[model samples]
Target: MSESLVQAIASNQPELNVEMLEDIEIEKLGEGNAATTKEKENEKSKKRKTGAPAERIALCKYIILDELPFKAAEKEGFKIFVAEICPMFQISSGYTSGGCKREFSVSPRLTDIVGKSIGELLVDVVTQWLLPRLFSCTLDNAAANDVAMRHVHSKLNARNILATNGQYLHQRCVSHIINLVVEGLEDIGMSVIRGREAVKWINASPSRSRSFKDIAKIAKVDTSKFLCMDVPTRWNLTYLMLEAALPYEPAMRLFQTMNPYFASDLKERNHRKMSIGVPTELDWIEVKRMCGFLEQFYNLTHLVFGSHYFTSHQVLMELCDMIGLITDLEEDEDDGFRNMVMRLRLKLGKYWLEETKLNPKMNKILYIAIMLDPDPRQKMKHVEYCLKLVYGSTWANELLE
Candidate 1:
């Protein structure tokens, strides 16, 4: 096999000649033992014939499952590894691997991305893929998604493929709902805005970042975690930004004292005048309080988005905890904290409360999931207790009925 490979390389590569092949020594296995050379040759021939195709198939599966680049097979190291395992098999080139056709097709859509257009496009894709049935489609909390789901529900119902008449066909994305709830608290005060400005200034350049690290080191703050800037649209990112910056509060203050230019730089960039500036002592205190409040929502969001296990049964319990958190925070002495919790409560009520007209009814699936919990401690009784806590005994009784 090595001899053949050498010959092939010499033939293909203009730089290599037949003379170079003379210096290459090919080792003969099972050379002088009990077995004859003829028997060894026959065994190798049989192995090559039987193992080559299976090895090739396994290689293909590896590439596809790992999402590796097609050019991986063309590398010299890869060819050598293949030779060591299955010497008789010929390694395919990157172009050959890339040329293998996929089982799916891509269709371009030039239409607007509204509900009707999205619904039609989804139906077309489902048909093209020959999907027999779809249990549900999860989407974010967009008004357009509501319309899209309704269109999809009608189309699926016409074909008699829907279970429960498509009642559960539109599964609202839990993470997105959590985002909406957390976003209600985003306007807590100038504290958040100032904190965001601080992070932005620190991360603006390599020199600033290095200087901050030096300050952090001197303050004995953990230099392992770099400051993170938050996107206003994502509450989770904002939570992360605050969480990262909280520990750096000491470092930030020290840096500000050491570098008078820091505050001046922020002030110079403050076109939003009243809204943007360096974080004050009160700002850090408010940020700390906000972090404490946002932590629960951030954790709940993470749990719901987990991929290792089904999280439906866990949803109601976490949401019940959220209700408890909001109710407790409502009594906080800080007026800003209480106001923020009130807003969060209103947002939660819009989606989870039974009587709110914003959502005509709470999704029955959440209740069904909790009832299906296998744990004796977390069965229907626990759900009833939570409901009673939120809606009182009378409303809980009505819901139970």
Candidate 2:
């Protein structure tokens, strides 16, 4: 906050108690980690005589979209908004008001994702929301808000930071879009069936769905002429393109009939790695699946992302719906914990886009949350992708130009 604002508040309060004013928690501008360094050093100094080797820090990472504006940087005509990720291991200490306030125990790691998503959101708020009223471009630079934003960016850079949602946070970001596509699959009547029982298969034992995939292959051959037509089946983006061309009703029925877990046996299912959010993190396979769902969207065919269902508009509505249904997702635990963590993740995924900064147009249509692989070694892969989209090719280099 600016000093002027602080003074205004202090003067308003007759008592002028500095401590009480200081106690109010401001949103994280990345200061949470300063306290942990001294403690770490003290431990090392004490342990030197006993001389056990110090513990190693294991780094965790994940990949977000390899680019921006869905890939091309400012070619989409937007500014870059960067975020620094700060993870806080915390503690609580008592205070006069009541009990304790939480304090961070370590420093935050920072990374720059400054690109279309952040820029658009900030611009949207400024232009569509604040500019028309709070400030006018016709006027010159205003005060606090812009200044606060710059300071926040500085703090993020001074501290080593992660993108918001950090590594796991990426999972949350893309899942919002994935969940929308999954729900879109449901829209063309994929959730119901006829004959022996469509609804039954859907509600059937997970194994029952396995039998349906087999049935679909048989049906494919038998109805060879009919199956030859394009169908929209976006279990992922490529599948979605194929599914989009088919007759909706049959395409959906085909989808519901497809078993998502065909390759695995029950033992494999049980052993499928996952983390209980409260207990531990997910295993690599589950993590890969999360990345796979997102990566598929940016692959070969999606050069242009906006469309009927795929457009930022439709994709965003589905996300808002997920947020509205948060209670139902929570109730999923009521069934007792088989894939409960995954299910809960699916639920949280719905809200993931809400975290991204988007223009109202994009915001209303799509939420673009992003997570990045923290290992800087992999950073170049994503950066290369962004460069391709931004510069059109490394040689053209308009961003550089």
Candidate 3:
């Protein structure tokens, strides 16, 4: 019947085509209903395809500050603080860019672990609370930490979830190791100690501090930034003290005349009068030189220990640059600087040797981290060569496993 109606329309007969046009309108309405039904089916199919909701698994790095001394908590015992930090993008949609989000798992309000073995306790906390999310752990280079890492590895292995077969379980704290290297330089130590003692005497009395500021003003030195005392354990504070005091040498000399406290304090502190109590002309010169020498370390420490982004790839390169700087300084003419440079070189070289030893599965982790970076990815021939040297020609193949 449809073929006959189409034939009549092709023949150009309007009277016969009128009924055919009405029938065509009825068929179009039915087709529209079928199309709507098909659309509903597609929506249902999509919902079925994504039945179980997708989850974003977050990766994090944990830092453990062992045995933090808090006065309030000290009534019971020392406290250990654990901080879990992760790149913001993984867990936070709003903070998708720039810096990591940090949460303290163990706050200072809690007392330190006692009676039970700390290593075992930490392992339990990590395995139970953080094992699902933690990527790696950073720790200070204390002898106790060596045992703790071993314990962590053993527990992780038992669960068959040890990352990289537990090879990269521990991250060496760069800041602490840098502090150790700075302490090893005896000449810098002497200059810093003298500067520290001078600042301490001035800070001990409000009158002396006020007088020192006035003297600095009279000497045309900028009084906007006041002198800061060095914390005994923090080498960075010593650097800051020397840096701030270097410009105030002339003012410090003039203030020594006005304040008898400076002399008496020095005398009392140095009972035998064995060392330079205050920063003399020579001491200031040494301080200036030490600051210059420490510039590379200061810069690299800030760079590698940044919280905003990953820095594991930069560790090897920065250490290499520092070693090169020390090697160049070794030939310097000054006897004191040469000795200091030698000690720094030796100290840094010890770490460099350990990192590049090409043995022990753990040491290769650093190289692997460098290779994983998109910017320096596979461009580090040194890392590749070391891996090849240690793991044979099939190192790339082995890395896959």
Each prediction's Cα lDDT score? 0.77, 0.33, 0.64
Any residue pairs clashing in model 1, and if so which?
Answer: none
**Candidate 1: TM-score?**
0.63
lDDT of 2 by residue, 1-401 (tens): 66787788888986866665566534233355444666775665566424322211111111122211122322213222211121121112122443221221121111122323343454455545433222111111122223333433343333433243121111112333444434343322111111112222232454454554455565563333221111234445323322222222343345533544322222132212521111011222232333333343434124224334333223323433334343344445333322433454554444442233322212211222111334454344443343343224643243223
Better of 2 and 3 by TM-score: 3
**lDDT value, residue 391 of candidate 3:** 39
Off by over 4 Å in 3: 1-119, 126-135, 185-190, 256-278, 303-305, 354-356, 359-362, 374-378, 381-401
The per-prediction CA RMSD against the true structure, in angstroms, equals: 16.6, 28.2, 25.8
Candidate 1: tens digits of C-alpha lDDT, residues 1-401: 36688878877997876666554432233344435867887798689868778877887998887656567888889889977866778866545443222311121122224777778877777778887887777788666666677778878788876678877778788888888778765566778888988888888677889999988999999646789988876888888899999999999889999989888887776534563668889999999988877898888898889889888888888888888888888998988778878888888887777742324435667777877878788788988988788777887888877
Local lDDT at 110 for model 2? 14
TM-score of 3: 0.56
Better of 1 and 2 by lDDT: 1
- For model 2, the local distance difference test gives 0.33
> In candidate 1, residue 268 scores what lDDT?
70
Task: Give each model a TM-score.
Answer: 0.63, 0.21, 0.56
Best by lDDT: 1
Clashing pairs in 3: none
- TM value for model 2: 0.21
